[model samples]
Target: SKLFGHLSSNSSPLFIMPTGRTLTRTEFVKRLREVISSFGINSPLYSGHSLRIGAASTAAKAGLPIYLIKILGRWSSEAYRRYISVSSSTISNAFVLMSKI
Candidate 1:
């Protein structure tokens, strides 16, 4: 099984520092900024919230029900609607697929 996969070799907690301590929110944000900046995205708009938005949008694009996406995102309110961004092309493709069905 995947339990013995090389990626799972580290027994430490999934989110930890080199010293095996859980990362502070500040440190996590700093590291996230660094990684995003390294990719030549100098915009400060990309934060942890971006990850949530991306997940919800990706789930939506994959044809997952909105209710399921809400649950997967652990969203408590309709605010989740603001997180999922569906592009025009995605909607067009969905319409074409549904027409075939």
Candidate 2:
């Protein structure tokens, strides 16, 4: 399947699996491991779950409101906090702003 193109249900699956269905957790894990290996990453902590966390964290870093991030992530409860992460740069910037106030 093409990596970049307009996609519709009639087109190739947004993400293809050898079995042509939803990927099993085992398959997802294997693929993530391979990609991480290719990148020479040495962390044991990255997986499919990281994608969700990264997306929520990225939206937060981009300054999107928490309510909107929750909605965009389909999070219905305060559990959204578990998915988002704040970076050190953001922490430092907040401290700088606070000091000026």
Candidate 3:
């Protein structure tokens, strides 16, 4: 299937698995925790929501507009605004750019 210029096999799962079974919430979290621990990250507070928020923050930092981020994140409401984590440097850069206008 073609989606926004990305091609995906219809029969393949987004997250490939040898078992060809979908991952349950618990299983996904367990795998996520394992990966985090392997990377020496001690925080156990990371969850699926963390990934969503991180995506939003990262997109914002990359200079993507909020609307585009919302679309990319599949956010249906304005609540995605809360997910953006703007840095001081980004704010200063924005101001610098606006000053040139």
Query: What lDDT score goes with residue 1 in model 1?
Result: 42
lDDT digits (tens) for residues 7-97 of candidate 2: 3123433456667787767777788888898889963678877877887889888888998777666666898798888779889999999
What is the C-alpha lDDT profile of model 1 across 1-101, one tens digit per residue?
45334223444434677787898767777889999889999847777788888988898888889777776666768898898887999889889999998
Assess the local accuracy of residue 7 in candidate 3 as a C-alpha lDDT between 0 and 100. 21
Task: For candidate 3, write residues 1-101 as lDDT tens digits.
Answer: 25623422243334546888877777787889889989899748887788889988898888888778877777779988898887898789889999999
Local accuracy by lDDT, each model: 0.76, 0.74, 0.77
TM-score of 3: 0.74
Which regions in candidate 2 have their CA more than 4 angstroms from the true location?
1-20, 98-101
Q: Please, what is the TM-score per model? A: 0.67, 0.64, 0.74
The window of 10 residues in a row where model 1 has the poorest summed lDDT is 3-12
lDDT of 3: 0.77
Model 1 lDDT, full chain set: 0.76
Model 2: worst 10 consecutive residues (lDDT sum)? 1-10
